[model samples]
Structure formats: C-alpha cells, structure tokens
Target: MTTHTPTTPEQLLEKLTALGIEATTINHPAVYTVEESKAHRGDLPGAHTKNLFLRNKKGKMWLLVCLEDRKIDIKLLGKALEAGKLSFGSAARLMEFLGIEPGSVSPFSAINDREGQVKVVLDTQMMTQSPINAHPLTNTMTTAITPTDLVRFLESIDHAPEELDMNNLAELATKAE
Candidate 1:
C-alpha cells in the first residue's frame, strides 16, 4: 500500500494555534488560481471558497469570500455596498495588506493584518457549510475549519465580516440576461 503523507500550511498552523483552533491542511505545490488548485484536491470533503481581494474607489480594502461556483458582478456590488466603483486591488496592495499573491488569495491571509486595514465579507450561504475549505496563506495547501471555529478565528483577528446574501449573484445574472 502506498502511504500518502499529509501536508499542512505552515503559516496557517501558526495562526490557528494562536486562535486555539484545530485544523488540518492538505499539502500540494503552489497553485496560482482556483483552477490550478483542483489538481491537489485528494479526497477532502467540504465546501471550497473563492476569495477575492478588492478595494473601493475610496481605497478601502475588502476580502470577499464565497462559494467556488458563485459569480459576482463588480458593478452591482459597487451599487449595493454604496462604495462607488470597486476594483480588484493591485498586486502591491494585496501583498502589502494580505501578504498573498493573485491566485493564492484566501481569508486566512487576513491573519497577517497587523494593522487591521481590511474588511472581510463572507457570503451568507457559506456560513451554512460545516467544514469550509480555503487556502492557508498560500495556494500550496488547503485548510478545513468548522464554521464556529472560523468565526472565532476571525474574531480573534478583530476581522468581523459582513455576511451578504448569495442572491446578489442571481440578481446580477438576471440583469445580465
């Protein structure tokens, strides 16, 4: 029998330890995008997330987490949040604030927010997931956590997220059609 070794996200282990949350990380080579991450998934069962790091015209930063299949309309989001026009934050902004690269973005990086300059917005539907999956700082690994533990971890980082309805996606889809 070929034994499979378990890999963990080093940064994530440190963060979860600090928050007193237990988690398991599936290790793989770094992936730059969600599409690339699929190659590393081996039998892990849970709802995976698609994390977007964005900023409003006002320079306010946001970490938006949603289901992998969810679609977002930046225009409608701007109108809903009353944030004028929103755009994907620059690579410099993302690295400086979240300490992550483009395809490796994940809510887990919010732990590096020593200045607390970013706001996290989670899709309400994601809250229903018992075991939510995300990249641990890098796309090299995926971490699974209980929703309760995740909330506590977010609170520990002082990053209280605003949960928005997934219906917003449907509205955008309808308008597009």
Candidate 2:
C-alpha cells in the first residue's frame, strides 16, 4: 500500500494561485472550535464556516460544510443525503481521507483527497455569503475566498461538491421522529 503525503497550507495556497483563484489569509493563534475562533475572527467579512467529516454505516464518507452557527441534525442529514445512520469520522479516518486533523477540517482540505474518496456537501445558505472563511489545511490561519472561487478551486482538484440548503435540516430531523 502506498502512503500519501498530506498537503500543506503553502501548497494549498500555491494551487489556488495556479488556478487563478484569489484568497486572503490571516494568521492567528490556533483555534480548535467555532467558539474559540470567534475571538480571532472579529469583523472578518463573510460567513465563518464549520466543516464536518462524517461516515455512514456503509463507510461512505462525506464532508459537510455549513455556516458556523447553523444547527445540524445529523440523523436528518443522514436521511436527507441518503447516507444512513451517520457518525463523525474518526481522527485516523480524517487524516487518511482529508489529510487534516479534527480542528483543521475545511472544504479546502479537498485538495488532499487525490482519490476523491470523500464527497463534499456544501450548504446553499452558506454559499450565498459574499466571502467564506475556512482553514487552509490548519487552524492557525483562516482563508477567505469568494464562493465562486471556492467552487473553482474544488473543481480544479476534481472534487465538484453537492450543494444543499441546510436551513431545514433541524425541521427534517423533527419530522423524522
């Protein structure tokens, strides 16, 4: 079995530049959660995001990107995506697939998924934000990019994502009960 080297933030930025996608990155103390990140993200013009790495019972993997404050009902999300009984992907699985750790999960990590083993699901509501903030392979910094540019970057890496409006995931969860 061949081992893959994880992509670094510099490399990720290089790829973005090579694709003609422009982004701004700000460096700060490491942040491990949305709450922790808020202190450092003051006035960052855009919707801050939270990314979830999940796996279904069948072992299919998904990367869910939504607004930082959006509430997700995992059970309903599973039903909505047809991913059956979803659970958070383990740290080992995260590194194996997205090439990032728990705190660093971001849509940008799609760059490391050369085999495209993880399907990306983007929140339509979050996508409407003019600029999106995500970690560039590490939580020590946040990178901001236009939503369209983000899609372009993902496509450049051959990971065109599925877009869903997650505003009603909570409602769906309730209905599922």
Candidate 3:
C-alpha cells in the first residue's frame, strides 16, 4: 500500500502562524456533523462554519464555506456557482487536493493546496463575523480566526476564495427551478 503523509493539526497551526494569522484552537471529541460539533463547541465565539468539497462536471473543484446553519442544496448551489452540476468530491480527492479527510475539510486545508486546484467559496454572511471557526486539519479540534485572516491565509496559499451571498444563492436556485 502506498503511504501518504497527512498534514497534521500542529503543522497547519505553524503555517498559520508563519502567515501572521492569529488563531485559537480547541480540542474536543471527534465530531462529523454540525449538530455534533455544536455539542462540543460550547460558548465559542464566532460563526461556526461548514465546508463542502465539490467537483463539477468539467472537473473543476470547489471548496465552499458557509455558516453551520445555512441550508444548501447542491443542485442549486451548482447553478449559483455556474459550475454545471456538482457532486461531493471523493475522500481520496479530498486528501489528494486538500490533504485532509472527510470530517476534517476546512478552509485551513487551503494551506496544503499549493497548486490552487480547488476554488474556495465563502458565504458572504459568514464573512461578516469577525471570527470564524473551522477544523484544524482534524475533526477533533476547531480553530478560530478572523474572517480577514482567513482570506489572508487562503491568498497566502494561492487559493483566494470567491464570496457568495447565501441568500442570493437561494434565490438563484429558486429562479432556476
């Protein structure tokens, strides 16, 4: 079996520090979904984010970050992004591109995507929050950073994201149908 070196949470934090991004991380039990995460993140200030790794028909990849509570329909989101039908990227692709597994997907993973193979998308609403919470290369920890720093980190790694209004996306989805 071929061995793959996974990026560890400590390495990711070091990368953030090198980029001058200040972040706070909390260790907790592994949580896969937003609901499960909520139970572990008590009183954590900032908007909790949910990330989606998607691939379009044309092989374009997208990493969408939104507020934990935002409702997203993949078909509608695909139309909004002009990506022409989107599907969840496979676990292997997730690791290959972002250097993380399923439950660990986050904008922080952008640090590993030196090739800029994936386009990062941020929910406009989520950006309004001063601090944003995301996984630190593992589901067992949540790292909090300012939205501005998040953008800076992505740009540092050559993956500056496209910001989209979730409300507008919902409208676009409705209009498409």
Q: Number of the top candidate by lDDT?
A: 2
TM-score for each predicted model, relative to the true structure = 0.85, 0.94, 0.92
How much is 154 displaced in model 2, in angstroms?
Answer: 0.7
What are the per-residue Cα lDDT tens digits for candidate 1 across 61-144? 888899888888887776665566789999878777876778778877787776788998888898898699988877777889
Candidate 3: pairs in clash: none
Per-residue accuracy of model 3 over 52-162 as CA lDDT, tens digit each: 999988889999999999988888899888888999999998888888989999998877776778999999999999799999999999999999999998888788789
By TM-score, the better pick of 1 and 3 is 3
Shift in Å, residue 15, candidate 3:
1.5
Quote the lDDT for 128 in model 3.
97
Task: Summing lDDT over every window of 10 consecutive residues in candidate 2, give the lowest-scoring window.
Answer: 168-177
How many times do residue backbones clash in model 2?
0
Over 1-177, each residue of candidate 2 has an lDDT whose tens digit, in order, gives 246899999999998899888899999999999999998888889989999999988889999999999888888899788777999999999998888988999999998888888999999999999799999999999999999999989888899999977987766555655
| Candidate 2 lDDT score at position 59 | 86
How many clashes does each candidate structure show, in the order listed?
Answer: 0, 0, 0
